[model samples]
Target: MATTRVVLITGTSSGIGLAAAVAAARAGHHVVATMRDTGRADALRAAAAEAGVAERVEVARLDVTDTASVTECLDAVLARHGRLDAVVNNAGAGYVGTVEQDGLDPVRATMEVNFFGVVDVTRAALPHLRASGGRVITVTSVGGVVGQPFNEAYCAAKFAVEGFMESLAPVAASVGVHVGVVEPGAVASEFIGNQGIDLPALLDAAGPYAPALKAYVDRTLAAFGQAQTPQEAAEPIVEALTAEHPPFRVQTSDRARAFVGTKLADLDGSVVQHLTGSWVA
Candidate 1:
């Protein structure tokens, strides 16, 4: 039997976070399944009970963007569990549109959650992680490593996260805290559902680049129309956390792996430029 570990997973209300929580509970870990609203976590709590790990699982409220919530939750967890063995900073969302169409504010919001949110949560949990020699796992995306059409803002946040984790890995390692990232292709999550921003409003407000913005908007919608499911996407994440020594980053889906691989091998940014327009350069 795998040794029991206590894990804290953010964004457990849906998608990969939910799956990771369930998986960890089944693996004999004491799972703290967190969502922004604990009242809405009924399904997750029920699922844990059904999986027979209810006794080992606790549902907590957390909002990664709010530093106070993160600090309070971590404090509560430490008060109860004494130490946290692992932290899965999976609380994030997505937005799809041209940078021009979306403007800086929308991109900033994406960064607030997908990038800074992860940074906030991880920073709050680091002291406990260091104490336990725990691992920090983040569910970034293939987009994090490589740019995609119409996804510049979302991709930018992921890219920032990827870079942040890479830098943090060596720093954390010195203190016995291992940092790893799970880069999945597309998960069947509400991330895309929430990504539906008012493109027309954005375009009308864009003034200068309306035509180009429309083209980018159309492309953004088309690309996400071909995303993978959350369960299938969560496999690589499971592998990363369960391994004796997880790689710094693991590409979950084949499409994600292949897509990212091509970008790395080609070295020609033209393909991405073609998809994302001249802004990619």
Candidate 2:
């Protein structure tokens, strides 16, 4: 933020991504906000305009799941900006179901978007980031630390992302690139609300998992009711970007910190099982 670096962020169509892009722009940085569909960029563009940071924000098309798309966006960013300071890997999707009911197909699909997508974007952006001695800030979830019921695929992908970044952070630091992960708890966004689920149909087809799934759904919905706004969640991301020496891992809120802390100290694993088990009870 002090130097006004050129920052590139993915998945800026809505929610935290949009808020992050706008917030970064408002901080006097050049923000290239990329999303899968540029047609859905009205909200981000409008927010930039409203914040009076429209000139600092540029919207681009990027599909993180596609290697070519990732390559093209990075290439374009360099060709236009001449240097890349930071990359925020925020593009991702969510899935809600157990492996037995969803099969391997949804699991693989979710991994493509949530896990491999982050890898693709980060891989493409690293060389440019290295040249500028920049940073890589990824938006992972608390699920990355603590597994939950009825979210096997989603948790697995986030866990993979966390592992990947944790392994890469030190190696990246050796070359002047700083890497950090932001873990957010429940965020009250369309991404949380619009999971494309049909409750009655899914429950009716759930077989023995129906009652547990129903309980999980009820608890999840209630928790999301108190979810933080996208703006509040985006604050940590900006902190990771601008802090003099950003921590490797940052939680968006105290609740998120405690949630991940529970996993960190669960040496026997019993504590986690006992805690998450009650979600489906």
Candidate 3:
């Protein structure tokens, strides 16, 4: 039997975070599933109970954007469980639109949640992780490697996370902590819907870039149609948490691997630029 790990996951209100939390619990791990607002945990709670692992899963409040909340959540976990065996940084926000259209504020906000949030949670969990030889798994995106068009802010944040984890993985290994990143392609989640972008309004406002924006939107919709469900995407994350020696990077599906592989195999920036530039043309 696999050892029971004390695992903490953020953004468990829905989607991948919720699925990961439940999957970990079903796998015999003690899961602390946290979200910014505990009131929204109904779905997660219901799922856990249905999975028959409800008792092993605890719902908590953790606002990754707030340092105090991150510290307090980790402290409570330690006090309650005495040790933390793993942490899954799954909380993230999405932003869509060209850089010029989205403005700096939106970029900063995306970074605050998608990038800085991971930094805060990881920072707070590292000491305990080091002590227990624990694992750190983060849900990044294929955009982190490929830089999708119209996702400037969101992609930038994911790219930052990829770089941060890649840089820290080796050093963390020295201290007996494992760090891994799970990259998903087009995930069927509320991330896009929650971006709060009004498609009709944004397209009408495009003016000079309307044709390009329309084409990009059409292509994105087609891709999302083939996207993996939250549970399907969460499998790799659960594996990362339980595997004896998980890889530093893992793509959730064959499509994700193919998309990210294009960037990895590119010797020059030419390939990526050509691909992304097509969206604006």
Candidate 4:
């Protein structure tokens, strides 16, 4: 049997976070499932109960964008559990649109949630992680490797997370803390469901970018039609948490590996540019 661990996962109200939390608990680990709103935890609770790991799953409220909340949540976890062996930084918001069309505020909001939120949580968790020689696993996306059309802000934030984790991994390892980033491609989950985007209204206000936006949305819809389930995408995150020596980077699926591989091997960047470029054209 795998050794039991105390794991804390953020954004567990839905999607990869929810899946990872339950999967971790089911794997004989104690899971602290946190969401911004505790009231929205019914689905997660139901899943955990059905999986027979409900008692091992503790639901908490944590708004990652707030520093006080991050500190408070971690403190409560330590107080309640005495130790946190792993942390899954899976809370994120998705965005669609160009920088010029949405202006800076929307981009800033995306960074605040997707990028800064991860940074704050990771930073806050590092001390505890180092103490326990724990692991930090973050669910970034293939967008982090291959920038997608109509996802400038989202990609930028993911890219920042990739860079941040990549840089910190080595330094963190020196203190016996393992760090890894999980890259999933086209996950069929409700990340931007919270974004409240109106497709018709978005295109109506596109101005000069309407054609590209329309094409991009059409292609994205088809891609998501065959996207991996949240459970599938969440697997790699759990692996990183449980592995004795997880690598700094991990792609969740074959499609994700191939997609991220293109960007990794592209010397002049023409191949990926042409590939993603076609989706918009």
Judging by lDDT against the true structure, name the best candidate: 2
RMSD of each: 3.1, 1.5, 1.8, 1.6
What does candidate 3's lDDT look like per residue over 6-26, in tens digits?
999999998899999999999
Model 1 pairs in collision: 188-230
Q: Tell me the whole-model lDDT of each prediction, alpha carbons only.
A: 0.81, 0.93, 0.91, 0.91
Candidate 1 per-residue C-alpha lDDT over 17-74 given as tens digits, one digit per residue, 9 for 90 to 100:
8778887877777889999988888778787778887887789999998999999999
Q: Give the range of the ten consecutive residues with the poorest summed lDDT in model 1.
A: 272-281
Candidate 2 residue pairs in backbone clash: none
**98, model 4: CA deviation in Å?**
1.0
lDDT of 2 by residue, 83-151 (tens): 899999999898888888778999999999999999999998899889999999999999999999988
Rank all candidate structures by their TM-score, best first, as comma-separated numbers: 2, 4, 3, 1
Model 4 regions lying over 4 Å from their true place = 1-4
Error of 2 at 215 (Å): 0.4
Off by over 4 Å in 1: 1-3, 196-226, 275-281
TM-scores, each model vs. reference: 0.87, 0.98, 0.96, 0.97
Q: Which ten residues in a row have the lowest lDDT in candidate 4?
A: 1-10
